[model samples]
Target: MNILEIKNLSLAFSVGGRYYEALHNVNLSLKQGEMLAIVGESGCGKTITAMSVLKLLSPNAQITSGNILYKGENILEYSETKMRKIRGKEIALIPQDPLTSLNPLYTIGSQIEEVIKEHQEIEGKQARIIAKEVLDEVQIADSEKRLNSYPHELSGGMRQRVIIAMAIACKSNIIICDEATTALDVTVQAQITELLKEIQRTRNTAFIFISHDFGLVHKTADKTAVMYAGRVIEYANTKELFKNPKHPYTKALINALPDFNSKKLEAIEGQPPSIKEEFNGCSFEPRCTFRKDICKVKVPPCIKSENSDVLCWLYN
Candidate 1:
């Protein structure tokens, strides 16, 4: 069952009295206890799409048309007061930078307990016990002792674990991880990813994992979406997408990954179009190696194949 769905979501920002669309008719859904990874280079609208689901977009960002449905209810129409109740409780965000999300002045335990108290109506000793339990759940060593330390005292990996603990404390149905492991080392990244998988299996929690690392996505995500120029160009089951990538952009991204067996890396030529740049047809036409004349004249519709949906002339 789908826990969250984003239908025809188009988002734009106002710059110098003019509106420039960043996301174009984006459609995606997350199933219960599924890890859906959104992967692309920087500025590919991955983060913005996740932010839209949480109703945490910037003041200048406008959703001209779209419906963010959470549990069959359109949250776009919900008021700010109503959204506040759902934000942390129903949908939690694990940001890219844990330090910025955490407060330095307060102890880690206090911050987590605050969330428990606010959402669950439990306070004092009860809340602290819940907080410690969550910390232990995230595999933080000596959970009770670590709780007394401030955010600054912990290492980058520990800080991220604390953030994950907060999400577990809330028992959120959906966790939006916006490059949550980007700042950690390889070992720590693997640990955090394993922790997420464990949480999903135990709690049946759905996840929207945003990252530029295709290799990481391949390992942790059950399904994957490849975004380019603010649009999802290809989506499929993780194994299927990797075995037979259809879109040129998706193929290029996969080929670019470092392989010890391979001698050289194949990098995609040219840069992705900026959001302000208008595209007459397919935005990736300029950089695509197998571009056809029709690719410049008309946009390709999303075509469903055996195990994937691709937005390119090759598939159409």
Candidate 2:
């Protein structure tokens, strides 16, 4: 069952009195206990799409149309006051930079305990115990002693674990991890990914994992959405998408990954179009190797195949 759904979501940014759309009719859904990975290059609207779910877009960012439905209710209609209740308790965000998300002045335990007190009925020593238990659940060593330390005292991985622990403490049903492991080392990244998988299995929590790394997504995500120029060009089961990618952009991305046997990295020529740039047809037409005259004349509609949905005339 779908825990969260983003339907026909369109968003734009105002710049110097004019608006440029950043997202266009984007659609996504997250199933209970499933990890749905959104992968694309930087500035591909991956982060913006995830941020829209929490209604945490920037001041100038505007949602032009669409609905963000959580548990069959549209959260876009929720007032700030109502959203406040859902933000941390029911839905949690594990940001790219843990330091910025955490308060440097306060002890880690105090911060987490405050969340527990606000979301749950517990307080005082009880809240502290819950905080310590969650930290231990996230595999933080000497959880009691570490709780006394500030955010600056912990390593990058430990700080991320603390953030994850905060979500666990709140008993969040959904976790939005926006490049949560990007700052950590390879070993730490692997550990964090494994921790997320374990949490999903134990708690049956849904996840919206936004990242540019396909390799990481392949390992952790059950389903995958490939975004390009602010649009989801392809979506499919993770293994199916990797084994038989349908979209040209998705194929290029997979080919770009290093392989010992190939001894060659195929780089996609040219750069992705900026949001401000208007596209007459497909946004990726300029960079697409198999581009035809018709591809530059009109945008391709999504075509449903056996195991995937692709946005390209070739599929149509």
Candidate 3:
């Protein structure tokens, strides 16, 4: 069963007096305990899509169409009061920088306990115990002592662990990791990924991991969505997408990754189109190596195949 889903989600941002669409017909589904990774170049609408789930978008952003459903309920229709109930407790976000997410002035224990108090209605000693338990669950060492430490005192990895702890403290079923490991060292990134996998195994938690690292996505994601110029050009099982990428953009991205033995790197020729730009057809046409005359003027419909769903004229 799908725990969360974004169906035909279209969004636009108003700038100076014009509304430019930023996401186009985006469709994705996440099952319980599953990890769905959304990958793309910067400004491909990855973060915008994730933020839409929490309704934490900019004031000028508008949902032009479609629904964001959580557990079969269309959360797009939820009132702010009800949405507050959903955030943190039902769905939590682990942002890119833990330092920015944490309150420097508050002790780690106070921050964690505050979330517990607000969401779980637990107080005082019990809230503190739950906070400590969550910290221990995220594998923070010396959980007891760590509680009294402030955000500034913790290492980058430990601070991230604390952020994750807050999510666990609130018993969030779905955690959106928005480039959550981007600032960490490679070894710490590995540790955080492993910790996330462990949490999934033990708690049956679902995750939406957004990142630009194909190698990391290959290792961690169960399913991967490749976005290009505001659209999901390809989506499939991670193994299949890696082995046989369906969309030209997806293939180019994989080919562009650096090889260990060979010094050669394959880089895509052009930049992604801006939201301000208008496209009558495929947004990737300008840089696609396999572009056809039809691709120049006709938008490619999402063609569903045995192993993948791709928006490309080649699939036709």
Instruction: For each candidate in the order shown, give its overall lDDT on alpha carbons.
Output: 0.92, 0.93, 0.93
- Candidate 1: Cα lDDT at 44: 88
lDDT of 1 by residue, 1-316 (tens): 6889999899999999999999988888899999999999899899899989889999999999989899999999999999999998889999989988899999999999999999998969999999999999999999989889999899999999998999999999999999999989999999999999999999999999999999999999999999998889999999999988899998898889885127578888989888999988899999999999999989889887779888999866
lDDT of 2: 0.93
User: How much is 66 displaced in model 3, in angstroms?
Assistant: 0.5
Consecutive 10-residue window with the lowest summed lDDT within model 1: 257-266
Residue pairs with backbone overlap in model 1: none
Tens-digit lDDT track of model 2 for 13-79: 9999999999998999998999999999999999999889999999999999999999999999999
Please give the lDDT score for candidate 1. 0.92
Candidate 1 Cα outliers beyond 4 Å, as residue runs: 260-263
Model 1 TM: 0.98
1 versus 2: better lDDT goes to: 2
Model 2 pairs in collision: none
lDDT of 3 by residue, 1-316 (tens): 8999999999999999999999999999999999999999999999999999999999999999999989999999999999999998899999998988888999999999999999976879999999989999999999999999999998999999999999988889999999999999999999999999998889999999999998899999999999998899999999999989989888888887774215466789989999999988999999999999999899999999888999999989
